[model samples]
Target: MYNLAKYQKLKNKINRIERAELGFFPTQIYKLENLSARYGVNIYLKRDDLSGFSTFGGNKIRKLEFLFGEILEQGAQNIFTYGATQSNHALQTAIACRRYNLNPILYLVDVIGEGIKDPKANILLDKVLGAEIKIIEFKENEDEFEAMYRAKAESKNYAQEISESEDDYYLIPPGGASPLGTLGFVNAYLEMKAQEFKEDLNFKNVFHATGTGGTLGGLTAANKFINDDIQVHGINVSHKDDSYLKEVAELSTAALNLLGIDFKLSDRDIIVDNNYVGAGYEIPSTRANRAVKIFAEDEGIFLDPVYTGKAAAGMIDYLEKGKIEKGSDLLFWHTGGTNALFAEKKILGNLLDNHI
Candidate 1:
């Protein structure tokens, strides 16, 4: 059902956008033979976890390739981003900035009470990269969202004070959810489509973790662009309200517009399964821990507690509940955050427990 002419046109439109080479292209896609047998469906994986720039690569690398391209084009020297103390986005941004010789300033919220002592996982990686790190703790009566908003405001003020000129610094939103960053996943969607055509396979469903919504927005936009019927399902890693779908739709439309595409996406076109977000973001769930072990033991692949583990658990649940039809073809996008395995015990939960 893929039209070569249309695909080529879309590819051309995407190629016109500026991008910095950051990660390896078309990060491996292959069949998950063992899981397929277990689930009674044809299972495949888009290995974005191996999307390299570092050994701990993840989904953020794709967004940074475009985001940094824009920052470099504008000739900014200082890059400021906000996230949790162990944010994969913040870590990836710091890595990309180091490669481009730009300064990375991170305003990170302490969501898991990492405290002021020795840091671990991505936080430790940020320090090793020499990023100017500022940890923001949640004040009394403040929730995670409030603390995140405060972190952004505080980072903006700090950037203004340190920058010699407005052009000297650039601010990136958490998860790189901006339109330009969303374009990275739009490109990723095309990459998957190309693979699908080459392999003569038609995927009925696509699954991945959704946080700030940029990746979901881009993939949805690309699906709309090609008029594909593949159902792209986002498994929430955190709590999000009904408005989250609308926000993702807006992001998708904006990214499509950047490519001169006239198609628009609405909330009706988005799909999110929130059933797997056990105990909210960064807090591991029993099913997710079980899913992690299953993947490692069966497929020899690792998934982080924060993102991929939750999404994978959701996919498995759908299959088990008969929400997805037997014999359906499924693609799981491994967006990567395996570094979190070495993070705090709270995030890791009972992952290694024999009873999980």
Candidate 2:
């Protein structure tokens, strides 16, 4: 149940923190009528995809609002971030940098080795935004995380050469997963609660794709803060180790602390289903592509193969497997990445196949 007093208190705490005006607030939450009928559940969508600043809006914009606020306040000129070549976070960071007249420097890991030669999708958009793009190629037998760590190290060296002092630049973690960035989604949760009050609907389950865990952390923190019973289920978009859940829990606690909320999140509070990662990050899956097609054909809504498609697949699988109760209220957070549909063929992986 939502407590108005607690909600107001939390909002006041968040009001004291600095944040840039970025995307449209309280992104429309409406029922997925066709899907709800098909699944025998009340299906709703939190349309973060329509979160504007661009047509390619996604969940990263939420984090960037808080991150850019801090960057502007600190008078940082260069903004450095990390992600895959087609990372929505990297693209959104570049967009935010452009908005604030800050220099956007990206150390993008070559997750899709084939897409590096010619720009497409987010990479093309990054170029158009005039971001200083640095592609970090993978070494033989090197994993994505290893390459990302190397990219961060390289970024540090580059920053030192270009800037007079550390204060002259800001380094945002991959996917903007820091405590400050997590505050954005905490604000998002509060916004959703306000909508719930207006709509007279109570969502019991929330499904969203989880990459670096900042969004999940913030949602979990906000849920705990308001004493809501909503189960925030993070559908893993990539292969994460056991420690990932612990890290998200820690992040949630940190965000709560920032809001002066005396609550802490535990592993028990974070629910992540890891069954639908398919092959790996950015590699399109058969089921995910099928899910994308279904959303497009059935609801006239588009979902990307990388994140939202896979998350929708997980939600469908849960419905089929009876993991989610029949007639239960489910809210799918559409953390947009539809631009990845235009990326290289390697990442698309038979997404256009008729069989899907």
lDDT of prediction 1: 0.91
Q: What are the lDDT figures for the candidates, one per model?
A: 0.91, 0.91
Clashing pairs in 1: none
Estimate the lDDT of model 2.
0.91
C-alpha RMSD (angstroms) for model 2? 1.1
- The TM-score of predicted model 2 comes to 0.98
Q: Please report how far candidate 1 places residue 97 from its true position, in Å.
A: 0.5
Candidate 2: pairs in clash: none
- Kindly report which residue stretches of model 2 are placed more than 4 angstroms away from their true locations once superposed: none
Report the alpha-carbon TM-score of model 1 versus the true structure. 0.98
Evaluated at residue 210, the lDDT of candidate 2 is 96
Write one digit per residue (lDDT tens) for candidate 2, span 246-288: 9999999998788777887888888898989999999989989
Cα RMSD (angstroms) for every candidate in the order listed: 1.1, 1.1
lDDT of 1 by residue, 250-288 (tens): 999999888887888999999998889999889999999
Per-candidate clash tally: 0, 0
Off by over 4 Å in 1: 2-4
